[model samples]
Target: MWDACPIELARPQKCAISEDRDKLYMDFAAPLVSEDLTLVEADPFQLMVRNGNQTCTIKYTDPSNAILSKENACVFAVNLEQHVESDLILSPTRGCKVLANRNETNLFSLSHCEKHQPHEESHFVQIKPHNKQCHTYCPESNLTFEGVNGKCPNDVWVMPMNTNFKINDVQFNGSRISIVHQETLDHVGSMKANMHLQSSVNWISLMYEINRSQPDFKPLPPFELHDYTHYVSYSFCVVVITALSLIICIVGKKLNNLPQSD
Candidate 1:
């Protein structure tokens, strides 16, 4: 019974306990807390219940930010002892610095409990682009750019696109530049699927249900414009001067060759 495992501070006002032959189930009424309540640096909530000599512990947790290596790849250092359902929420607002859930989307979710190296911080998950030299940048004028073959770090997202939150479209010269116009859901979905296939961790899945109304945004293109006006103008002037000089020489030679006429 839940009475045996008393909850501290906030007790369940309404609870139901059911039991089958080999298993037991319990349901309780409790106010839901916002996932954003937890700070990125802070440890997660751990609930402990004691029944005589035995104790049961349950943790409500989220994953920390994956560290960026010198190679510019994301290396997630995970404590193997942590065996709880965790969500690695990614957000463009938070950039690549923190993994806080404020305005975040669930990029990876882990539910299975498997014993791994205990107590030590091990390299648990690594997500990197196939080509480190290649970076994806949104050109200033357009919303659509080439997608990185693999996940690459952006200002906010570790991946090329956020799974849920849509970044604001660039407004240039009274026109909206948007990736939603150039890229389809199917294209992004296929990318996420391919990452899962190439992924080494089997317990995690790209499980975030993207809201159709607020579609995910591809990263904004970096502000870039190439103009050769100076070079072109200089070349044009040089050609004109050269042609005029040749015409003057030909005219002077013709005058010199012509016989003087009264």
Candidate 2:
């Protein structure tokens, strides 16, 4: 608990919907400081999971087993084997998420996001059988509004996880820690903090993907964001109006000062 709020994190895991909609699988690295939030050292944290009737703990560590560990840090895995015919709501009795505990807020170690989010619940619908016509349906998801069928044009789900080198040594000057890195993919998706003795340890997770489409590669949108009319200047209108006003004023002044018609 860095300020009494669970520090948020991200990991690459197989986030999927259940086949019977009764349970799901979670496999990801421990939550790292969110690139979106203000960060100070990426010190590893821990978790106390309460999932279903079973319980387990996992984490990612560096190859040498150092602070803010890596190599698949903080792994939270839950497997549910319920094959039902219809879609069912996953009750806490049937299954639950592996949440984090705040008993040791001061302890720095690698842990899961459930620690940051205490009231997070997840659910998934089991894949239904294909009809005689060989047609099936997709589990309801953000990607599918009314739920799609086996004929969904988009069938790919990718989760990218990564393990960059941890800061072995840092020069702490009061509230910030100083470290350096050369050009590499690790530099992407992270925001550098300008502080002394404080640092935002960006944790990268591996990529997990599920492709439900055909083997042949195909463009989904068939267009890029720039492909559409996408130029937006919040002040463009004002600038144009100001320029027009200046021109009009200049022209009006010239007309007023011109020799009077006789």
Candidate 3:
């Protein structure tokens, strides 16, 4: 069971709802005929459209937790005459909106790099992506060459990985390394790359010398901290002498009071 949905078309083509409600049938009058495209629930909030080998994803934006219904789902109708792989087409329904495609450029690459003089240690390069968003994503597969620091090879292409999806600066080396802030995306110097190569041996030697010659700063307490060594020794001697004198006096008194044992 299906209801008529509003559809806007740039050219002449008829879109009809299927009986099963899982597919959208597109009919091109006369000689041009195409197969039905199926739409299935990919997840709770996502729908996948299958047009032979090609599949396009659609996300449900409604805030409410409603089941997949005809009101919110649509299939993208792309090229059909050549039977070329296109996004899915689904049965139409009321209150549906059509999203049209436009010409959007997605580019990512290091435009240029050079060192002015043969003996110059500093090199200037230009990094370009279609936009700042692409710059954030290009570093992952582009940015630094293979190997670390001085050991990098010249001929090797930037580390390879899957770059099929959307490109953004954060998706690239952001995880592995720091990325430029959003505010810097529009800065004039954003594309400038200044690389200065330093000698590892010299760096290590300098660090070692700095560490060895560093002055050791010890923490000192706030109080004066008098020793009191003589006071302690004298007090201990007085206690011992007093104890001996008391013992002697008690012994003498006991002897005198013995009452002539004889």
Q: For all the candidates, what are their Cα RMSDs to the real structure? A: 25.4, 28.6, 26.2
Task: Give the lowest summed-lDDT range of ten residues in model 3.
Answer: 191-200
Considering lDDT, which of the candidate structures 1 and 3 is the better prediction for this target? Answer: 1
* Model 1 Cα lDDT, one tens digit per residue, 192-253: 32332232222222222111112343545787544686778889999999999999999999
Model 3 Cα lDDT, one tens digit per residue, 106-167: 11112222223331211211123433232221211223333322221222123223232222
Best by lDDT: 1
TM-score of each: 0.15, 0.17, 0.15
Q: Give the TM-score of candidate 2.
A: 0.17
- Best candidate, TM-score: 2
Residue 29 deviation, candidate 2, in Å?
43
